[model samples]
Target: MASKGLATKRRQESGRRKGKEDGDKTRGGGGDEMKAGGGSSWAWKTKTENAKKVEALREIEQLEQKINNLDREKGVHLYNKRSDFRKLFCTLEEQELKLNSDRKTEKAKLRQQLNKMRGSVTKFQRELHNVKPTPEFVEKLKEIMETIESVVSEFKEQQKQIYEELLREEQTLNQEVTALEKRLESWASAPPITIETKSVKPKTVSSARNVIADLPPEVAAFERFLLQTGGHRGGWDEYDHGTFLRIRNKFKGKSAFLDEAATSIPGRNITDVRQHENWYQEYLTLMEKKKDGIQKWKIVKEAQKDECLTQAAVDEDEKKEEEEQKTRARARRLEEERREQADRLNAWKVQKELMKAKEEEKQIEIEMRRAKEYEKERLRQLEVRNQVQEYLQRKQEEDAIQRLEVESKKAVQEEEKKTMSREERVRFLERDQRRLEERLAKGKAKEEEQRKKSKRLERLKGQVEVQVERDPSRLYRLTEGWKERKKDTTSASNGPVLHMPHRAVPSWRAGL
Candidate 1:
């Protein structure tokens, strides 16, 4: 019985070794080898544990294959999604480009319209500047000119009548002078007629008939002196003759003239008369009377001649002055007429210029108003364009921020996958998802805050624009304030901004 038991035990040990070898092969050797070197009971327990370990390793390998397949599928899906996102982004870019191009075209059309309006306004202004006066004012001026011409014609007719009358009078005077000259010539040429008559005793003519020839020598000499001293045609009057007679009477008793007479007479012998002092005195007195009378008559004649010449000169001067005055009056009237015509022409020109100026001013005012409206519209267009540009810039910034966040999350996921087991990796993914959610929430909150700030800024900008429109004087101040607020907001949030997945910033906020 002992021999039979030993053989059976050896057989059992061989079977156990064979099973250990199989288990080692299945468990990749180490655990099964340690169990094979141990006791029987421990070996049985190790075999079972090795079997379970082998099963678990097979299951793990199958699961790894599945995980690898899933990872490849996930990679393909992510690649396809990335491609779709790229295509979608390209499409959006194309659409945005098209929209921008359309906007540019619209802006150009608007500018063309504005330019055309400005050109029309300028043309209208030019036409206004060249405007003419109304026909009614021209007709009124023509009537005034016609009235002035009629008055001038009437004055010329009256002057011509006066000239004709003077010409007739001159002709009559010339004819009378000619007739008188002919009569005198005929009388001078008449033949002398001799008449025969009987001789008769002639009566002595009265001394007064030949008064000049019958006068005494001294008186004759005095009379000759008076005639020589007198003006042409015996200019001395009765008053002058009386003055000469009175002077002669005062010297009548003097005899100084007798001595002079004795020397002057050719055959006179007055020695005895010269010896008589009384007779000498009387003769001298008579001679002195004659001299005095001659001198007095000469003085009176000269004075009368001077008075007559003065009167004649005065009359001539007055006549000449009257003629000059008439000439001056005619010249003045002609000058006045010329001045009036010039004034009328200048007034017409001034009125025409004033009318043109008024028209130009009206046109200028219209042009200014149109220009102001155009400027306001242009400014509004510019503001819209600026808002669009700002919106585009902000969108670009948000897109860039989202791309950066996605890339960072992908890097973190790659790192977690590299370091963690599946379950740990899953926990890490969940944690990351949670963190991402929190970050997204925070980003959303920040975006909301930024949106609110932008909205506030927009409100402020609108208020500033309203103020600027209402009272342009405050434009500078409001603009400065807006700029300052914008700077403050920008400075306060100067850090990097993260974007959320769902929410989008408004275009107006981009403006802020």
Candidate 2:
């Protein structure tokens, strides 16, 4: 018995080992060996290091896969992706926010440059309001834009003509170059044609604009001044010799190409070719105006020095820039007023049309509602008509049933009457009483049958329905139910039902 038990235990152990092997093979590779010290149970140090290395490598691979899947160019998480729900939603919302200060400044600088060229101070300043510029700053900006506009307006037509002239010159030069190349080829055996590469210089709309852009922002304000005044370095390069010499004498130590050009000249008169045009004169005037404005601004600051700009009231020196602001504001106000006036006229016209349309729509709606109501009433009337028809059908069925009962009872009585004289009938009834009783019973039962049928219909129609036993065998079992019922109903015999009681007649009528 002990040997058999041992044998059984051995078999169970062997089966468990086989099952474990199958399960291990089915599940996966033995990667957990790495987690268990890289399968190096013998050496502690190597086991730890190898396991750490494997884990690090796996983490790096996962991160690389993630990075590759993501689009880095957009620099934000993709909302459409499902990889990481919370992180992606937050990142997308952050990216959708408006620009900060650095971006604001960049955009402002770009707009200032564009508007300087475009020459629309009113539009530019309105746009600039978001920049939180001071009243003084805004006024200065308008002044500068005005000057730039004046310069461009003066030179725009001339510049167009200059562009045309340059185009013609370019065409002539090209023709000359072609002709010379042909001649040179022909004259290879002869004397070479001395055609220098006479490339026509193109006319440029070179702006003091770019100068402001190029200048280190340490002197950015001055550069801005130059831009505003349309005073290109090229223009200043064409200054008079005497002024050039004087500037050289004053700023002897400055080490800029512009400074050198302005200061030093050879035998030629730099300004003789192109003196200060209205633009240069305007530049000087602009400088003076800027100086005056700055001085006044300083004075205003001084007056408000003890009394703060914000913590105190307005002072007299700020009055001028303020007046300029009011004037510009008034101009914009008038322009806006004109626009509003036109808008009002348009609004009035639209309102009249809308009113007319609304009136028409109201009438149409009212008519539609009335029509729908009329149609609904007609439908209700139709439903009532159908209900009346159903009632009439039910009444007709009841009347037919009543008539059938009356006719059947009358026939039974008449059949009995034809049998014999009353004394003979009585004698004959005594003999055939059981058969007559059955006939009367059946006839009486039929009367009760209708009443029972009506009661069943009322019960069935009135109550919530419950399913009934509907097997054919069950139905067959009830096949003779009506006949059986009829047999039980009548106690009629040859004795006079001489005056059928009212209660019996009523029950008869009810059955029918």
lDDT of 1 by residue, 50-165 (tens): 77767866765686577566645434433343333444344444544565465466446534544454454445445445556988655655665565556546645754674576
Candidate 2's residue-wise lDDT over 112-200, tens digit each? 55445544544564656666558987786778777867765754565467457655544444433443443344346332222212263
Candidate 2: worst 10 consecutive residues by lDDT?
A: 189-198
Clashes, model 2: 2
- Against the true structure, candidate 1 has what lDDT? 0.56
